[model samples]
Target: MALSLLTPNSLTKIPLTKLRFVPSLSPPPPPPPRAASVSFRRLSIMSSSNGIKVGAAQMTSTNDLDANFNTCSRLVQEAAAEGVKLLCFPETFSFVGMKAGESLQIAEPLDGPTMRRYCSLARDSNIWLSLGGFQEKGPDDAHLYNTHVLVDNYGNIKNIYRKIHLFDVDVPGNMTYKESDFTTAGTDIVAEDSPIGRLGLTVCYDLRFPELYQQLRFQHNAQILLVPSAFTKVTGEAHWEILLRARAIETQCYVIAAAQAGKHNEKRESYGDSLIIDPWGKILARLPDRLSTGIAIADIDLSIVDAVRTRMPISEHKRLESCQKISSLSSL
Candidate 1:
């Protein structure tokens, strides 16, 4: 039936089934603001069954082990309260010493008192944790290993990654670090499973090497990449965020970077901009700058990672032989 509208001057008839309603041409209203510093999608995937809540925490660690422990404890509590299932802390989190020699004094066995306390905290809080950058005592007393550990919700040590690439660079005016002098490089690359997804572990200086991240993603099928760093003021300002985003985009996975911020001691300062970047290289949550210290929680959707890789299919297109040839040529 046709509906007819009668006006003072005229009458119009329109069939309901044939008539179309057009929307206003004005642009749609802007999205509602978020409480988190910045959320890429503004979609809260937190409570989604397949989505996991993760937090990356930045720190200003010092020579005092006790003080550092207190700082970490507080951060963990805060994250746990926010329902962050996995909490990641910065490099040298156990203790960043004043002198390189002090690392020798504090470097402990994997089962040391500090580690035991960490286990207790993770278990009691019911949160999985990225306990990054512990000074691990090496055998024969020759060198210490900078270790990154993933603790399960039960507080069990799931995986341990000793940093392979030592930062031996001499950045002019900003900082000069000789990590090789005090630390031994790790031989094996570690990629292991967690409650969230297949987690790949690397530390500070490892960020410069894209090959490590690539292998972790393609070779080991890592869905999340961990980069807990104590980045220097110079390089971090210029390279940190971009490098992290590049890795995430290249790997088609999540990049969670918990960093050391502010001055640790009289000798050193770290550029702090701890970030959580999505597979598409969007900054989901970031601390903004080096002076900030806190945990930033974001939802991790593994499906997004799958979708990106499935669509782009870059992994299938990687040329290993050609890359190796280029590497050989560069060396020669």
Candidate 2:
């Protein structure tokens, strides 16, 4: 079970000069470079009762920050043209440093230049963005936080979630990645309201834990779950779609997954199959090519979420059973 070698594919780069971004209205001045508290900013267009269009982007990111930004900018324009209100990006969207200590060397705070450009892009495009798995500078110099940022259409920082489940696996003769070596685990579970619905934020490794998804649905009342990942080819082929569909069915929530695809570097490659699954475990959208750089477009309807939950009514049943078990234990 040796690690398989992947040949890097040449992706067509869309020049920023050719693309156009038309804001719906005048965008406000850029906010100060500081991390804003967790809050939701609703846009007038997002408040409509109809279903909202969203996009999940898949791309191969490298150590070059400028190139990655260009790729993302192009996707934003394409999504906006298709009337997408929200677009989600994959983990490590900015830079994927293959070497040790490289990410820490370039890690920036929330208010850093890297984030400023993304904020400006969102404002100019007038589209909400979910930037998952940014290497954020931590409290100390030795470590960094794998941060996920949600920005509003107006370029406001809505909320941020650091990845709590650090990937520390050592499969003999296969893949061995120790994410905890350089990254610090996040302490909080973050959820926020958006144009689509109540969004539950979780990064790559968080997908393996069902309890996290259950907490998001039962406790946080999250209607949509976002899983941004860079899954290895082996594991992704085995469980990616199955786990995503299972989470959607059990939670009765929409699941949108943005993924990193193709060979990023000689030593690293990702299994890319970006998907958007509905509450009923149906795949609404997915990229035709598993290893291409593009977005999966879909419409998120809250009405469908309600319809599925109403028919199944699993949440209520689970609560009732828990209460009964507690009452029985007390009597004993």
Candidate 3:
């Protein structure tokens, strides 16, 4: 199925029969009056013999490392206490610098003290964590990699996916931000099996590119797609939910988007509506307030992935020429 074919109207057309939220997990607090409200369709979920609980977090991170970790620790504990096996955090979960050179100044190796702290937190909490958009020290001194790290319940580093697409857009009327200035783009596409399901990893800007996601679903056989983003308020308001739902609908996979919300510094602000959507394009959960710091919890049932795929069979029907074109175009 072509991603372009899936639209806002398509979201309303999907047939839904059984809607279920995890019984033990409570919904997140209501968003403030000022935040834009998103009405999620609480429709049916496919029956599953077993499912894994996951949490997608939203937070406003600053240059203060300790403070950010404190918030992460608190959220990790909360998710763990609720029997969540995996908890995903947003981009710049550790520290969002106030100045331009700040991230470059503090970029760390994957095994550095900063990562060690998060790894230890995962061990202590006994929960798997998806630490999105860590500023990892790159091959050259001038650049860093916007790396995503996945830590297992045992606190071991399981997988890492550096962001392949960089945000270098000049939004009309809005400011121009060039991620490539400081961060190097990653070359490899990554996915790995987990307790939840086969996971496809991508960062913020990558969400705008559906071919990468097609490769993950068609080639990597990913059952869930993770988008950890620090999206600009301008774009997030217009495109975040629409693009996320489109991806889920097209791929027949669960999408867990942990986003940075609210104002981080004078120059940086994120559109924060952390969401977890099911394979049927139904939003399992989201924090209504786009700028609140919290986690949206949902159950990832692989059965739903199977059911959706069996019903639509897009993977089976995808044109061979289209698949070839997507492969050739995104190979770089």
Candidate 4:
């Protein structure tokens, strides 16, 4: 007997299980160069708290932490001014170094000045923040983790998801990065509560794994997914948009991806095109390519999640669990 896997319409990219994770590099979060890298509503197309208004920020984070904070401070103010309840930032939002190993020196503990600043922003603005990826000082003396954090509107932390999947790849002549060299991998999955809905936090490379998303959306009941990334130019152009839209469509949840754009350092260039996608797979708001520092805002409606899932019942029809087992089902 043989087992067969079923996939949705052809619009979906590679068969569900066949997709591979392609890794990329990120710039430091504090200053320009490369550092780092939401949804809703039927609210007025631009700004409001009438519904869930979210912001996606695209930045070129550099080696300087102070400079990067200035950029983030400005964007956070802009988002708050618009009455955005939640803002999603790209990975490495706090610090990226001139080179790879430099992150070791800059990595900070959760209570460090970098995180304190983020908490202050959320508290002052009364907004939730998906403070994507940061260089965290690991338990050991020599390593760091690509950590993702969720801060509530009142400036309290609700979740911390270290990147479970690290970006370690070789794009041959275009680029080759081994994130493991500078950062460690996270071991658990986080689907936590937020003002809008249950939020699932993931980083750049994690986008390629549909299984992880399945667990987030179905098992954990996450209604919105946040991917803060600093995807490299080569892969971002080829796979970023499609991957994001597909994830939204599959999970029937709002997908917010804030990305790193432009050249970050002499060694790296990020693909910018940060986006806010709806549950039905529409691109709601997106930052233009190559923008140095910009915020793309949009409305997010949770009702749409129910509507999409009810209309197309994909989760109910799936035959395989997140990790497929060859012998889970015997011959019919």
Candidate 5:
């Protein structure tokens, strides 16, 4: 099935029936206000201070750089026209499955054609953009890194986050991916200030680590977390939605994830349930699997975070005694 782009009006009315919620390990308190106000520089109507509209685009990219870029351009335009202030594209948005050694050949510099195209699109559409992982050329002609690039509406590069946790796992009887063989691991965690709110950036494999999201929300005060992924079909089907919802409910932040879907190259397939979860862990919007392209939109209310946190106050409940016991045992 081909993916569909949902408008704000249509998306707002989507019944919560389609939404799925994880049973929070701890029961959350009652919800706070249903809406809150927000403002954005480029998005005038969105400035009503009520809510911020964010979007996710699911894409299937191949070895052809030009074709993938064109598809992304169209989807960004469509989301922008629908009044999306922030949009996220799937991981490996530029080039997907080529030969193992071929990624270096397709890798581009940060300011090269691929980024330039995205910058132009951000400026033209006046939307904050986060394109999923791109193949970045490293030191020599042989090394590369899976990098996520962020661009503001003015077309300036806001930040770049290299995938910190590389996918180097071997799935039983299926596939083995050795990302470290070709890509360099990132050294730093990235969080940026934006017009909408504070944003935390992470790539696919980072989702498995809950500590990262905790630091992003509590330490950095991130209002929205961006996860761009190209999860394998086996892992994604088993853990994608559950892990995403768990992060949202635990952190009380909006979770926006863009994913690569459908079959790629000869035998590789990506799990395609691209989604946007609210602070309450409600699945606001989602795209079906096995599609070339699809878009999901949602209104993210910053006030909900405060309401949920205030009601539960779990983040503040700490047992220094228990922590001390664990630390003392480690010393032995």
Candidate 6:
């Protein structure tokens, strides 16, 4: 029996009786008095109703797919060990710095090998996971999409959001990313019911578009916004934290951003600074540059979304009356 490729199902079939079964039968301790299992009614009353702990994982990955998977697995395990209900990883975590047309070679079917691996990890750790920008093979194999997927503790995929806004910028002296050259943009916005709360999903460059977040927060009632980014060091230094905090303050939603930080492929440098921000625009936990792989755990109190909105009443203040003038002018 080869131990390397054995699965749980395969291991279960081998009879234990066929193998040596050593038993310590020295008068098994007198059966302890049976204890009644607590009813669901009692358990619900004792659990906290308002808060859930979530984690953001920062991964520094290279072109090696196996190494990247292993690193992500370890970080997820660390987060699960710390009792985090959900964990998120940075963008393009599986393969970074691959040339223009090279991603196609690595792209997998939505239910293919990569997802199976992720599903297994999610079930084993019993933690919800969101990995940024998996290379997903499109319909008919015409194009590949940079897709973000959410998996529940049961290893079931809850939602998939392809990168709605591709990175088509060409910055002088810094970086030039023309994602549109290889990938097609996704049209739909994805918001899903998660264990923590309603979650709105976005990838790296999509963070720049405020309208997306606005629609997600106001229309969809998203409580948490997940941004898995691989921002360049130049832009990240300038706008990463500020933009993340601004989104939290504007939407009144907890922002969990896991970013890639440091140099990769002997050329490109990513701005790390993975952060977890509260609805009040306060930084709860942050992983600074060069931290590599780690978890940023934060208590996400969904109540804060209401509390801040109630105190400020901004959402209500944007009444039809205020927008009427703008609408009337546009109509004319």
lDDT of 2 at 257: 94
Most accurate candidate by TM-score = 3
> Which digits, one per residue and each the tens of the lDDT, describe model 1 over residues 66-149?
877787788888787777889899899888888768989878988989888898889999999898899989764768999998
- Give me the overall lDDT of model 1: 0.78
lDDT string, candidate 3, 57-129, tens digits: 8888999999899889988887888788999999999999998899999999998999999999999999999
Question: Candidates 1 and 4: which is better by lDDT?
Answer: 1
**lDDT per residue as tens, model 5, 38-109:** 111111112113577788888777888888888788878878888788899889988886677877887889
Kindly give the stretch of ten consecutive residues in candidate 1 with the minimal lDDT sum: 38-47
Off by over 4 Å in 5: 1-49, 288-292, 320-322, 329-332
What TM-score do all the candidates reach, one by one?
A: 0.82, 0.83, 0.84, 0.83, 0.82, 0.81
Estimate the lDDT of model 3.
0.82
Clashes of each: 0, 0, 5, 29, 4, 0
Name the TM-score of candidate 2.
Answer: 0.83
Tens digit per residue, CA lDDT, model 4, 66-125: 888888878888888887888898998877677657999888888888898889888987
Which segments of model 6 are wrong by more than 4 Å?
Answer: 1-50, 139-142, 288-290, 320-332
lDDT of 6 by residue, 122-203 (tens): 9999999998889898654557899999999999998899999988888767977888777878999999998798999999
Give lDDT per model, in order: 0.78, 0.81, 0.82, 0.77, 0.76, 0.75
Q: Which stretches of candidate 4 lie over 4 Å from their true place?
A: 1-50, 321-332
How well does candidate 4 match the true structure in TM-score terms?
Answer: 0.83
Deviation (Å) of 147 in candidate 5? 1.1
lDDT of 5: 0.76
Error of 1 at 122 (Å): 0.5
Per-residue alpha-carbon lDDT of candidate 2 for residues 1-332, written as tens digits (9 for 90 to 100): 11111112221111222112223122223323322221111121121135688889988899999989998998899889889999999999999997888899999999999999999999999999999999999878988999999999999989999999999997554579999888899999999998779999999889999999999999999999999999998888778888998999999999989999877788888887788887877566676556667788776778767767876788877876678899999999
